[model samples]
Target: MSQRYHVVDRPDSRAPLDPRKLAQVLAQDGQLLLPMLDLIEHAEAAVDDLIDVMGRATIEAVLLMSAAGVAGPKQQGKRADRDVVYHGSQAGRVALKERQLRVTKPRLRKRAPQSGEPGEVEVPAYEAMRKDGRLADRMLEILIAGVSTRRYEHVLPEMAETVGVSKSEVSREAIEAGERLLKGLAERDLSGPDILAVWIDGIQLGPYHVICAVGVDADSHKHVLGLREGATENSAVATALLEDLVRRGLDPERRRLFIIDGAKALRAAIDRVFGADQPVQRCRNHKLRNVTGHLPKDQHEQAKATLRAAFKLDAKEGMAKLEQYASWLEHQWPDAAGSLREGLEEMFTINRLGLPSLLRRCLGTTNLIDNGHSAARDRMRRVRNWQSGSMALRWTAAAFDAASKGFRRIIGYEHIWMLKAALEEPAKDRSLVQQAVAG
Candidate 1:
């Protein structure tokens, strides 16, 4: 074996308990015996306590080594040059998820700083945990995951008891965290994202409805644009969201596509804010749902197939076929026919623009934003009652932030060029074409 390095079977340290002694004690007659569950619990507690003890010992060992100038043993001549001296130990506490250790924290005094050296001596471990905010962040993550504050005592027994975790404190922290997220969402600069399209939809929480906009950039990345609380998808609410986007750097002159559920107010808002000629695609899926919802169960599949097939054809033919279907259903199901006829032309905007099938499939509906809403609902599923719009907005902002983390590029991203070309067509050229068609 080399003198420089050696390995021992076990380090010279005192074991907390001897396994053989424990077994002998357990086997003794007329002794109070622990049930298996209690024994296992006690064993786990012992292990945790031992781990804390080991950590404290390691910290003390490092302090000692620093004081000696070398990691372990100092050479005879080199020991005299040591600059760090261990002062004394003071009571201190550090938190870990499993436990908080009451440590005899070692103090160190260092020689005066030489040129270019730091003057202060600091505890590396203590400073590290404090700087990282891991302890606070871990607690916040637990609460955000819908863990009850009372149960935190069980989850983080030592830290919770030591710091006195309270329900009010947890609620305050969560609200503060949520407000920070909401502020970031509202104030974040949208100029950099290169948004190519925006999808808007409403989600209901309790009796409140929040309209959310999710934007897709040229690179196919999605961003949670913003949100507004509204009772219905009305012009005022829709205009506010669009104007907010414009204020935050969305270019109304850029001719980006608006993928939305077919609401007259939303369409009117787009025409007023963006332009009358702006490219808009009403969600085909929403239209399908509305039409089929009004039809008899026996007629649903047939209507759905007819509508879906018609949507695949060229704009004029598709509209003609749908009109024929509506006429056929006019007598037995006038309401269903009317639902199908409403916004019928807007549903085939993608086809009219002659976008590629792949890109059409991605942008033809507001499903992308709807998917994000689904994720937001999953995050907020634990929330029972909403107190106000502000409260709902804060929670929704936090939920959106969480949901947006997993956004991948839109499907059929490669064919995005086809849609881009359609959008880039000149307004003057489109106007003249429409005029000629009308003539």
Candidate 2:
């Protein structure tokens, strides 16, 4: 049929416009739109896989050299010169990495039977190039950022007159690689950490929310631990995340403490999984704000001083000071004070254990856990339009994982007794818990 093409014919559109060129550009742009992340997943897999493949390939190459003498030549009885060496072969690796399959021609020297003259033996090139391996290490670093920082399309460069990588290739390569690798961390089995502590917090990235758990070993070394997403940092959500950790082999019960913001659900989940048997320390800073809320604004400054005094005072002074604070709160705002004072009561109970400094440091609102979240938030703040909760978790897992790396154990061994004793107790004796901590 005679047709009228619904096409725009502007000066830039026509003269001799090409549809393929347009479609190619459009398709490429479309690929860039794909939610491809960095090559983080395949990077890990590739590192392992390449090590395996290259490793086996090198072995096979050496075997070939052996066979050149054992099965085919007299020199086969001698040691193969290649020896599957790990170093001094940049050319071999460069070619192998670039090609996904490399072909290495091993040179063999032997005495010629015909003339007793030295003749070099030619061995077929053992292929060692991995076509997808180029720029992977370099691209890997970028890919990790693309996924963690969610900088997907901007990952590539060399695109224009001004300068930048073409968006399409960047998407096709870096992000696809990263996205694949990022997925790996989700499915891979994580070994159980000593888990001296589990620090939990939620991070906001654009529209998504990610709850992060950082685990610390007995030695105080930390791991990213786990990540989850939800409407709020509730116990159910924290429990679900902990469940996932269980599925992945993390033993929460074995963890010494679950360091988290003083959220009910988190506490509930800890009690559910670890039981009230484990020591639950309120983050000290949160406790201060919480207890101070019971008093009037005019009294807050004075009440804080009183509460601090109680926290640091000897047993009897601490008791009287707490009662004084509570009595004042009951007079000003009974309900608020009642609710706020309940937690302060827990703090007092923990402190009576004689693990005074440890109690103040651990059972109180934990700046370590909060500090971890703050750093994570700062890093992911720049990412706009986070795609989903899982997407946010990816960024969180990497960020929190990276942030927890420097955690140092500030609590001393002498203090471990109160915490350890509290953990061993059968009943919920806040008094005994306090005694152990105070001791």
Candidate 3:
């Protein structure tokens, strides 16, 4: 067999080449074609070794450029008038992407203008590379993506001399990042978003209960409003969460619909904070589950169908059908009947508002907020222990912050205007009623 090689012509060595243009071309192409003989000779080299070689070369180039800016050229003759002088090189660690890289950093010293004291001059490149603020962000992202702290080091790219990958350091970075996220979420301004509805729900993390509020704006965009830690989803916890949201810029007087799981405390808190006149919608799913949970398994489908069908009717007709269903259950399952009757009117709030079917479906339940809670739970699944309420809050905030990035407009967002109109009608009616009474 005869082996044939493809020959390529080399560029003229006499031609003046721009280093920056060559770099730009290489960066854009991301590869260089080598001679066949050289390629064959280096075929056995591992990719990891090549990457290390390239990284070191790039770092050296950057340091040289940075050094030139401060200490001038290396081979230049010494001058007494020089303001800065090379102070030799030192081994230093710089943050490189998700990990740290050890490099030889060139040092320079500056002489004081009046006093002859020497001051250390910072290498711009080294200082820029040494900033590890993004390292904390990367750690939080990895941890939130389900990488455990113990396994954090293993997940990172292998480096020759990396630091801050130990389990303790990883934990500290995640804690600091989580605290920042918690603070950011807590302090976010809610007044800017023209929120048309708010959903409140509680999730239990170990022994702690956290009440979370998510708002749906006029454009059907959801915002994580606030969270409060409590022993349970009690009136105080819900009240505190709502108050925090209001304090952060959620308008208390805004005619927005309040959606909540069938919790009396949550309903009470809404009435207390946002006023009793603010429309409240009980989660139909929670209501169905609560009502059916009291009955035999065989009766679940029938009861659920009845409740669901009733939700589609007009407010009066829906309430009447629910009342009839409650009466039927009262004979055999008074608990089920009571559950059905609980917050009965609020279940029909969306229907009473005369919203379009699409808006009604979107606003009728607490699923908007529940979906965010699901994302938060998935992000926090690796957390084995909840050390304290603050820890739980921190993790929850970080998880939700990560989750919010993937959120899109709610389903039936096109009909969001209908909801806005529906929410405003009651406020308009109340104003008119008050005026008539005053007259």
Candidate 4:
């Protein structure tokens, strides 16, 4: 008997090779030189051919192993009589990235029918194909790319027509994808990243609220750290989000800056989770809006300009100037005065630390988190009704993950080293103060 062999094309086959195409392939740098049209035609054929070859090989290997008594009898193992015999192959199908291919799997049965039980022999090849998730992944990718479920038949009539009507299959696959993403976000180790600052904020979707934390690393790159579902931005919800990050290896003791809107719950959460002395920079923009809302419409611009001018002064001078303005306003508008005095020291945190204008511009506001919320909202704008908190969390996680792709270093990022130095100053001073108190 002669052994059959299948031949493949040679890399430089001179069999009617187009010289222009060959020249282009040679001149190009590292890249796939296969023609697009040819790949589409041959890829499916290759997959089918491979599956059929593997199917036959699997059966042949099983027969050989059975005859050799590999699974029949062994020392200290259950012994089987020579009653089991080979049976005809059964038709099956395996999913591949290109398409589904038909396969024939051989079976074995007892020579004497004691019972209707069939002998089970493992097919490693078929199992490998079954475990290959590229087909499902590609399907989900297409769906995310705006290919509607109804159009799957028209999009890939040869490969995905069955999938068009299998809405449940698509849903199951999407759920798996979403769970994987959520798990990755939640369980990722954060100790490896040199996170220099955290921007925290809450976003509302229908009746659910999600508090999200975005971290800025030492290199000025941004990361969506984690999120928690909450009914409102309360201390408990904020604390849980921060604690989860800590459990995932975020060092709460580290003197990283915390930039947040004027939420007392977030401030308290930071103090409780990180430390009472942790450096917190209240978003100056939010403060400005709150302060100006108390003044008359005609006085708003002047008040904003006054605060802006005060921010340009040094920390001591800025605080004194703001305090003077508060005193002046106390005569007529006490509410506005109280607003300026509340968290007044935090308003000039960037100034107190003496960071560069560019770096301060990035650290002085919760704009980064706000921008992430805006991007996330844009991604989920089509969602009309968020049925449950879990649903909102899933969709928000997906949206934020999508938004994270567009994150670049904050503006004036080159001077980030200055911000890092400033963040360290407070911790150093506190240690010194503690030592003095001990003395």
Top model by TM-score, which number? 3
TM-score of each: 0.73, 0.57, 0.81, 0.67
Ranking 1 against 2 by TM-score, winner = 1
lDDT of each: 0.70, 0.53, 0.76, 0.70
Residue 208, candidate 2: Cα error in Å is 3.0
In model 4, pairs of residues that clash are none
lDDT of candidate 1 over 28-47, digit per residue (tens): 32123223213322332232
Model 3 lDDT tens row, 312-388: 89888888999998998999999999999988988988877677777788789988888878888888898889999
For model 4, residues 1-439, the per-residue Cα lDDT tens digits are 9999999979768775443343323323213322321332333233333334333233233223332332242224444466664444565555655345554444545666556554554444445444556666555545544454555556654521223336567656756776777888999899988898899988999989998899999899999999899832588999999999999999977888889887888898888899987778889888899999899998899899999898888777888899999999999889999999999988876776667877888888989999978877765665666788887787677777777887899998898888788677766685774455335
**Model 1 misplaced regions, further than 4 Å:** 1-14, 17-128, 131-165, 432-439
Candidate 3 wrongly placed segments (more than 4 Å): 1-54, 76-88, 109-121, 159-164, 426-439
Candidate 2 deviates by what RMSD?
16.8
Name the runs in model 4 displaced over 4 angstroms: 1-131, 134-168, 295-299, 327-334, 426-439
